[model samples]
Target: MSLLDQQSVFSAMLQAGPFAVGDTPPLAHPFSRETKAWVQHIHGNQLLKTKYRSVRNQIFDLLGIATYDEVLALIHDKELRTKAAERAYLLLGNMFGIEGTGQEVIRHLHEYARTADDVISSLRAKVLAPYSAHIETTNEIVTTWDPVELLLALFDDRYHKKARFEAKRKLALMGLAGSIDQRERETKIGEKFLTFLNFLNAFVWSPDCKIGELDIRYLYSTHNRENFSCSAVKVLSEEEARLIIPAVGEKLTLVKRRRFRDNGADIPIYVTIRKKEPSAKVLKLLRKNEKNPATAVDDELGLMAVLNSVNDVKRFVRHLTRSAARAESFMTLEDISDTLTGGEYRGTATGSSGKTSMLKFFARTGGMRIEFILHTNRSYLNYIYQRDVAHDEYEVKRIFDTGVIEFLFPPDIYHLDLQKIRDHQLAWFRRRIEEN
Candidate 1:
C-alpha cells in the first residue's frame, strides 16, 4: 500500500474498533512485517526501549498486536527483519516528522505516537474557519498581511504570480505539511512552547507588563480572515521584513514599502510574539535526541523586542525585570544580556564571536517558560538585512545543510534534488541582498 493508504489504515485502526479479522487481519497485513521489525529494533536499542516502555501499551493497542512478545515471536527471518526495520524507520519518520536514524528516530516516534490525535484536535480548535471574529486583535493591536504578498515581495513582486505554486511545491517537499500526521506531530512537539508564547502574549497586554506609571505596548499578528482564506498569513512590518527576507530565502522578495499598509497605530517599540513555526519545530526535534515533543517546551515562545535605540532596549529589559519581580510570579530567570550590560560579547551561531547580536533568556512565569529576544533597531536591522548574518539566510542554510530538506523531501517523491535548489536559493538571496 502507498504511504497515504498506510496512514489511512492506521488512522482508522485508532479511530474505530474490531481491529483484526478475515484473511487480511491486522497481523496478516503487509505492514505487519515492518511493524514487527520496528518492535524488534525498539527492543534491541536501550534508549528507545525506555521510551517504548512508556508507551508500550498504546503502541500494541494501536497496531492491534496483543502484546510485545506476541509481535516479537513473528519476527523470524533475520535479513528480512533488518531490511524491514530500515524501511520502517525511514517511511514512518517522514510521516511522523521524526528525524535521524537508529535509536533516536524510534525514540521520537514512540514518544509522540500516543498524543498525535490530541494535537490535531487542539490545532483544529484554534484555527477558526469561515470568517469568525478575530479574537487575537481584540486585546492587542494586530497588523494583518497576506503571506502570499510576502512571497510576492520576493519571487513574483514584479510579475505578481508564482506564490501559490511555489508554496504548494515547498509544502509537498516538506512531507505534505498540511497532512493530518505531520500537523499532529508538529503541534504535539511544539505544544508547550506555543502555550508559553500564548501566556507571554497575555502577560504583555496585562497591567503587569508595566513600569510604574508607564504601560508597555506590544504589536502582534494573526489571521485577519477565515483560516483557510488567502489572508491566512499576515503582513510583515518593515523591521520584520528584514528578518523575513533573509529567513524566507530568494522567492519572497516582494518588498514594496509603498504598498505596505496597516492601521495607523504607533507604539515606541513593536513587540512581535512568535510561536515557533511548525516546520522549524520539527527540524529542532530532529536536530537532537535530548528534546521530545512533550517535555521540551523552552524556546517555543519567542518574544522579539524591536526598539529604537540600544538605550531603549536596555531600558525595556530593566523595566521588564522589575515588572516580573513586582508580580512575584516568576519561577526562574537567566539574564543573558551581554550586549545590554557591556559584558563579554558572546553572540553568533558558534558563540565564538560577538557578530550576531541579541539579548535573550528564558523566564518561568505564569507557569510557562518563554524565551525573550531583545534586539536594538540597528542590531535587528543587521540581523535580518545584513549580507552574511541575515536570519532568513541562516534559516535557508540550516534547512539544506542539516540534510532535512533531503530527508523530508525524497528524490523519488519530490523529483527535485533539493541540494542544488538550496545552493541556487542561497546565491539568489545573496544577490537580492547586494542589489537592494
Candidate 2:
C-alpha cells in the first residue's frame, strides 16, 4: 500500500486493537493536535465559514455528535467506544473530508446496508449494520430535517444497544442550530455574551462579520492576541448553557444562542437581508444613519479600512431564481452610491450569455486589499453593451485615466447566492453540493 494508506491502516489498527488491555502505550493522543487545529482553522477561515450558516452545522459534520469538542475532552474523561462501527463512521468521515450533514444519511438507506442481527458478531457489523436498521426515508434529494429518532438510530450498537431518546434528540438539535461564536465560548469568552444580549434585543451580528484581537507586546505586531481580544471571534450570540455530564464522563455543553452585532471584526463580507423596504429604500436608511458602518481594517490588521476590503451588496440571486417575485427587490448601483457619502461603485454588469463580473475587496479582517475579477455576469455584454454601450463607456472613461475598462460584470465578477455558490466551496458537511 502507499505510505499514506499504510499509515492510515496502522492508525486504524491501533485505534481498533485491544488498546487499553495491552502493555503498549494505547496510541497516546489518538488524535493529533492537527485535528484540533484544522477544526479551529475552519472556524477561523472566513471564506469557508461564510459558506456555513452556523457552527452547529460544522459540528454535525466534524463530530457525528453535536458536541465533537466534547469527544476531544473525553481524553480527560476516558470514554471508550464500546461500539466501533459508529466510531468508524465518524473516523472515516473525518479522514475523507465528508463531515457535513448531507445526502448520505438519506441516500445510503440500503446501499452498503447493515443490520442489528449481526451486531454481536463484530464492531463493523454491530455499529454499521444496526444503523441501517433504523432507516426512515431515502432519496437522491433528501429533505432537510431535525429528526431526533434518526440521530438516536445512529448510536444503536452492541454497547449502546438501546438509544437515549431525549438525550440524543437534544444533541442533534444543538448541532443543527448552534453557531461558531457559540462554539468558541466552549473555550474562550467575549463575543458570546454580546451575542446573547443581541438576540434578546432583537438585532443580530452582521453576516460574514469580521472580528480581531491584537498582540500587545509591540502594540501593532501580527500576533497580538491580547490587544485584539474583543475582536478575535466574529460571530457572537446569547445562550442558556446546557451541559450534560454523561455517566461515561463525557461532558456535553451546548448553548442555545441568539443575538449579534457589527463589532467590526476583519472579514471579507458583511451581509444583511433588506426586509420589506424597497432595495432603494434600504440604501436611504443606511445613508441617513449617523453611525458609519465600520470596515474590516478598523478592527483587524489596521492596514486597509474595512470599507476598502469589502463590498456590501444586497443580492441573493438563488432566492431570486426560485421566486421571480423577489427579483424586483434587488438594489441598483445608484442606490449603493447614494448610500455612501462618496462611495465609488461601478455599475453591476450582466451579460447576454448570463455571465457577470465586478471589482471587489477579496481579503477582509486583514489587509483588506481590492482586486477586479469577473463573476456573476459571466457573459453579460448584452446587458451593458447595448444601446447605452458607447455612451456609458465615455462616461466611465471620463471618470478613469484608463480610458478603457473591461466589463466582467455579468457573472464572474460580483455575484454571490448562497444556494448557487455551494458548488464552489470546500465543505465538510455536504458533498459536492456546488452545482456550477
Candidate 3:
C-alpha cells in the first residue's frame, strides 16, 4: 500500500479502542462511528504488536514484518522466497521516507550489503538525483583538503627529514650557526632527542630577519590627525625601519585621522615595528610538519597597523596593495580577513560585531619578508583583552576539553573558577549579537 494509505490506517488505529497505558493518553471524549470502523479495520488486520509497541513498530507491522531481523533474513534468503523477499525489500526501501526509520534503514543497508545497489539502491538514486546541478556548482568554488592525509604526512619519516633539513637551512641562511649546529647534534642523538631539541630551539631562537637597503622611517614617524595623535611607534633596526617605513606609508593615507573622523569620530592608529617571534609550538609545527618551512613562517620582520572602522580596513588593504605593487615589494597576500575564529565562543565577539577582518601580506626586500596585519578598532580591543586577560582561562578550558589536564595536573586545577570567564565571554557575545 502507498505510505499515505498506510498512515491513514495507523491514524484510524489510534482512534480505535484498547489504547496502551503509555501510548499517548486517551482522548477525553468517546470515539465516533467513523473512528470505530477505523479501529476495527486496524485490529482485524492484527496491526498491533504488544512486544514492539511503538508507532515505529505499527508502521513496520503494516509492511508485513514483525522485526528488522525478519526484513534482513528476507533480503538475504535466495531459495524459498526469492521473489517475495525482493518485493519485501522494495517495500522497506520505499518506507525510507518515513523520517526516523529512513536513517536506520540506510545505515543498515550500507552495513549489510557489499555492492551499493543492493536493497535501497533505487531510493538513493531517486533522493540524490535532483541535487547534481547544485553539487556541480559548489565543486567549482570550494577547495577541499583531507586533514587525515595531512596528519599522516606529518608522521612520515621522509617528510619529517625534509622538514628538518628545511628548518636547518633557514637557520643557516639567517646566520644562526649555533642553532643549526645544535639541531645537527640533536639529529645524531635519536629521533626523539632531535624532536625535543627542535622544540627547544623554536622557543629559544627568534628569526634573524634583516631588510637590506630599505628606508622604513615612515612607520615610526609621528603624524597628527585632528585631535588624535598616533605617535606610539618603535623601530628595531635601520633595515627594518627602511622596509617598514615605505610599507606603512603606502596605506598610511587611507588610515589617517581625518578620513576616520569623516565617517563618525577620529580613532588613534597604533603602529609597531619589530622582528616576528615564533612561539615554541609554532616553531615545532614548522620544523616537524610543514612541507615548505620558509613559506610556513611569515611575519619575520613585521609591521602591524591597528585602526578604527571597517571602511578604514578596506582603504588600508587597497592602499597597501597599490603601494606594494608600485614599489615591487608585494610577494603574496593571505587574506584570512573573511575567516572566522575557532572555538565554541567563536563568532560570539568578532563574528557578530562584523569586526573579524585580519589581513596578512608578505613584502619581500633582499631575502626578508615583512608581514602586515590590519585590524579594526573593535577587533584590536577584543584581541588585546583575550590575549592579556582571558588567554589562560581559554587555554585551561581547551586542555580540559581535550581531557589532557586530568593526566598532567592535579584535580584542584580543574576546579578553578571558570564561571566568571564564561560570563565575560557571554556578555561580549550578547552585546555583539544585539548590535548586529
Candidate 4:
C-alpha cells in the first residue's frame, strides 16, 4: 500500500461515476486583448520566465522526456526520483526539439534521478507591468508601468499576498525555493518553464487577461507583421487525458488530480498517478498534421525548425515590449468607483482599462520549423474595421522591420545537437494584414 498505488487507484479514479470526462464546451479565453494587454509577466518568481518553443524542444533531448508536459505532471509528485525524470525530461527537451520515444526516456531517467541539483530555473521579464496602458511606438504613443509598482499597491491588500503565496508554493513544488539573484538559477528554472510552456501552451493565456481587480499587464509594442498562424489544442469531453513526463525521481509521488481555474476562468486539468510510470498520450494531432514523413522529416525539418525559431523569437520580444507600453493612458473611471460605492466616489486610480493588439503571435521550434504565429484579439476588431487592416499587410511589415526571432535558451540544451547556426537568411519584403 505505497501511496498512489497504480492499479487500484487507477481503477477507482478512472472508473468512478463522479469524475468528469472533460468539458466539451470551449474553455473561456483568458488572454483577450484587454486581459493580456495588461499582463507583462505572470508574477515573477525568478524560476518562471518567458517560455520559448525553440528552447523547449532542445530541452526535450537532455532529460529524455518525450515532452515537457510529462515533466510538469511529474514535478508535483512526492516521489522525488520519479519526478527527477520529469525535470530531466525538461532539460533534454530544451536541448533537443524531439527525443526518441521509449528506451532513452527510461535509460536516462535513472541518471537524472541521481543528481542532487536536478531541477533548474528560468527567469523572464515582461516589458509591461499591470498598470501600463500605453505602448511606445515610433508612429504611435504608448504608456507603461513597472510591475514593482503594482506589487507595492498589492502589498496593501491580502489578496495579492495570497496570490503570491500560492505562486511561491508552486515554485517550491518544483524544488525552486526562495528567489535567487543569480542568472544561473534563472537558467535552471527557465529551461524547465519553457518546456512546460510548450506542454501547457493551451493554458498560457490570451492577449487579454483580466483577473478580477488584478490587472495582469502586458507590454504594448508594435511591428509590421501582417500574416500569422494560430494553433489551438482542444480536447473534447470524451477524449483521453494523459499526463506527460519523461523520467522518475525521488519525490515523484503521484497524487489526486485537482481542478484549478486559470486567469480566464478555464479550469486547468492534469492526470494523477501514484506510481512509477507517468500517463501521457503521444500527440496524435501534431503527428497527423505533420507534412514530413518520419524518415525524411528529422533532419530537414529539424534544421529549418531551429532557424525559423530564431526569427519568430526576435519578433515576439520586439512586439511584446511594444504591447506592454500601450496601456498607460487608460484611467480608472470615476463612475465605476461611484458605482462600486453607490455613488460615493473614491479617489480615481489609474489603469482600469488598457489596449492590446488582438494580434497575438509566437515562434515555434518544431519537429518542423514553425516560423510565425499571429494571434489577435477580436475585442478591438471594431476599431480596425474602419481602417480595413489586412493581416497579411501587417505581417510583412513586422517581419521586415524586426528581422527573425531566435532561441535564447541556455547552453547544453542539446549538447551541440541543435547548436547549428548554419547559413540562414531572412528575405526582405513589405507586407501587411487587413483587420476588417
Candidate 5:
C-alpha cells in the first residue's frame, strides 16, 4: 500500500476514537502519533484487541513473518521493506488498484466535507440503483425513502440534531447502512472481475485443451441410480433453473441461494465461482500480504465442484489431472481431501471461524494458477444447510468478526453497532436461504 493509502486508513482510524460525532479534527498528528493513538484505542477495547491481533496474525502469515517484532524491524531494513512494500502493493492493491493511487480514499474530514454532497449523492445512487425496481420487496425498509439516504442527506444539510439521533438509532439497529465513498471503484472492480471470469472460461474450455467431464457413473444418493457424468456447459437463467433435474434441485437451490451471484447447478457440473469484491479484496489484503498478484487473480477465478460422492469427486479430479497431462500443461496439485474429509472443517477468514469441509487444491497450468474445491453431495449439503457452518452465515460473520467492518465503518462517525448489524445480516441471509 502507498504511504497515502496508509495515512488514509490511519486518518479514518483516528475518527473512530471517542470523539463526538462529526466533531473530530483534521489528522494533523505525525504518523507515529496517529498510529499510537489507534493502537491505544485498540488495546483499550478487549473486542478490538482480539480482532486486531487476529488481523495482524493473518497479515504476518501473508508477509511470511511470525511475529510483531519482525514487522517493527522492517523500518530499518530498507531492502526488505522495499520487497515487502511491493508484496503489500500486490496484496492490497490487487482489486482495480483502487485502494492506492487509482482513486485514493478521502483521508481528511475536511476533504470529506468538501465532497460530502457528491459522496452522499453517489452513495444514494449506488444503493438504490440495483434495488430500484424491487426496493420495496426488501423487508429492511418500510418508508418510501431509504433510511441511509435520508439520514446522510439530513446530516449533510445541517439538520444535525435529528439526523444525528436518527442516524445513530437506525445505525445501531442496521449497521453501516450504505457505503461512504466507493463511488466508481465498485464498477471498475466489477468490470475487472467479469474480465477475469471470462479468462477462466476460456482457459477451461480452450480449443487446444479443456477441462471436461468423465464418463464414469455414480449411484446418486437421492436417485439411488447410476447417472452419466456432466460438465458445466452453459449458465442457466431463472426459467431454465426451474427445470432442474429433480435429484439435483435441492442442492442446486441451496447453492443458488448463496450470497454470491456467480454460481449455478443447471447441469451436473455443480460449479460455484468466488471472486473477492472490492471491499473484500481490501479487507483480505489488510489480513495478509502474499507473494504476487497471481494468487489474487487465481482466487478471483476460483472454482468449486460438488459431486454425488467422495469416490465420484476423486474420479472427477483424476479426469481433471488427466486432461491437464494430455495438454502438457499440468504443473502441481495439492490434495487436502484427507484432512477435510477427516471431519475437520477448513478455516476461513481469520483462520479461526467460518469453517467448512471440502477437498481443496490449487492447479498451476498454462501459466495460470487456479484453485478447485471438490465437495461430495453430503458435504455440499452440510456446507449450505448446516447450522453455524453455512457459507451465507460465514460471509456475514467474517466482516464483523475480523473487525474490518469497524475499520471501514467506524462506530463514532458511522454510528454503527457492527455486532447488531452482523446479527441483522445473518438473520436476513438465513431468511433468504429458508425461502430458497
Candidate 6:
C-alpha cells in the first residue's frame, strides 16, 4: 500500500477511543465512508489478501462477516458497518506497522480490552467484595457515602433551594456575588463548590478505597486531646500519633520555610495543627447536611501553613504537591488556591480580605484525609482578627441556626447585625492587605 493509504488506515484507528475484546470497535462517525472503502479495496485484491491474510481474518472475526461481499452487505446497518470498518482499519494499520499476521492485533486487543464478563467480575471482586464480607452483618453495615456518592448527591441537588443557598454563601464569602445576576452568581458558586467537592473527593479516595475506614486519629498526637473537644474523638496509640505528626509536619514545614526563603522572605513560618473535627460540627454536618461522616468531616485533622508572602504561598503549594506525588503516604488532589478567601462562617465580612490558598490530599494508609491552608502572614493575621472578633456572634448564630438556644431566645434575636461585624473584619482585612 502507498504511504498515503497507510497513513489513512492509521488515522482511522487513532480516531477510535480504545479497542475492547468481544465488542464492536467504536469508530468516529465522520471517517466511516473512507474506512469502508479502504477495507473493500484491500479485501478484493487476492495478492493483498495473501500478504495480509491475518489482517483479513481478524477483520472477518471483528465484523462477524464471512466474506468480502458480507462486509459490503453491512452498509444496510450503519452502526455495524462503521464498527466493522474501524476494526478493519485498526487491523490493517497494525499489520502495516509490525509486518505481522492479524493475530498480533487480536492479541493487542485482548490485552487492552476486557470482556464484559471479565469487567463485571473484576469490579465485583475489587469493589463489591469489600462489602460482601459485611453482608452477614448487613444491619451492622452503617451506611456512609463515599466521596463519589456525596458528589452525586450534590449534583442531583444542583437546582434545589438548599444548594442554591450554599452556592450563594460560597460566592458571598468570595466577595464576587454582588457583581453578577442572581442566577449567574448561583451558577458560578455551584460550579466552584462542585469543583471543591471533586478535589475533596479525590483527596479522600485516592488509590481507590471505600471511604468509611479512614481514621482521623492517625493524623494527630494522642497527647493532643484538647483538639478533639469538638468532635467524636478517638484516642489511638501515642506512638502512632507521634510518628505521623512529626514525619508529616516536618516535611510540610520544611517545604513551606524553604519556599518562603526562596521567595526572599526572612520571616518565620508558622504551622498550626488541628487534631480532629469538633464534635458539634461533625454532628451538624452529619445531621443537617446529610454528609458522609467519613470523608465529609475532612478537617478532623488539619494543618495550616502560615507564610510571609503570597509568592511564598504559591511556592509552598507547588512544593507540597510535588512532595505528595513522590511520597507514598499521600496523594495530592486539585489545588484550591484560587478559591481561598476569608472565613466561611457568619460573623466575618462577606468580602473579608483574609486571603489564603488550600491544598488537600488523601493518606495512602488508614484513609486519613488532610488539608493544608497556605496563607501569607498578613492574611493569617486577618484571619485571626476576624475569627476572634466574630467568635461571639458566630457562636450565637450557630446556636440559633442549629436550634440549640431556640427555647431561650426568640427567632427575632437571630437577626443580629452580621454585616456590621463583617464590615469590621473586612476593614481589618483591608488594612492588612494594604500593609502587605
Rank all candidate structures by their lDDT, best first, as comma-separated numbers: 5, 1, 6, 3, 2, 4
Error of 4 at 319 (Å): 25
Root-mean-square deviation of Cα positions for candidate 4 versus the true structure, in angstroms = 29.2
- Model 4 / residue 402 / CA error / Å: 5.5
**Candidate 3 weakest ten by summed lDDT:** 140-149
Candidate 1 stretches greater than 4 Å from native: 1-61, 65-267, 277-279, 289-291, 294-297, 330-332, 335-337, 340-354, 412-415, 434-436
Lowest-scoring 10 consecutive residues by lDDT in candidate 2? 401-410
Which model, 2 or 4, shows the larger TM-score? 2
lDDT value, candidate 2, whole model: 0.24
lDDT of 6 at 377: 44
Q: How many residue pairs clash in each candidate?
A: 12, 74, 5, 132, 0, 7
Compare candidates 2 and 3 on lDDT and give the better one: 3
lDDT of each: 0.42, 0.24, 0.34, 0.24, 0.44, 0.35
lDDT tens per residue, model 3, 260-314? 2223333344455554322322322222222232433443356666655566666
Worst 10 residues of 4 by lDDT: 276-285
Indicate the TM-score of model 1. 0.44
Return the TM-score for each candidate structure.
0.44, 0.17, 0.27, 0.15, 0.47, 0.29
- Candidate 4, lDDT over the whole model: 0.24
Q: Write model 6 residue lDDT over 235-278, tens digit each, in one string.
A: 33445545553321111011222112223333334555554322
Q: Order the candidate numbers by TM-score, best to worst.
A: 5, 1, 6, 3, 2, 4
- Expressed as tens digits, the lDDT of each residue in 119-178 for candidate 4 is 211111111111112211111000111111111222223233223322222222121111
Where does candidate 4 stray beyond 4 Å? 1-186, 194-377, 380-392, 402-436
* Deviation (Å) of 19 in candidate 2: 14
- Superposed by TM-score, candidate 3 places the C-alpha of residue 213 at a distance from the truth, in angstroms, of 21
Show the colliding residue pairs in model 6.
230-278, 230-279, 231-278, 231-279, 276-300, 277-300, 349-422
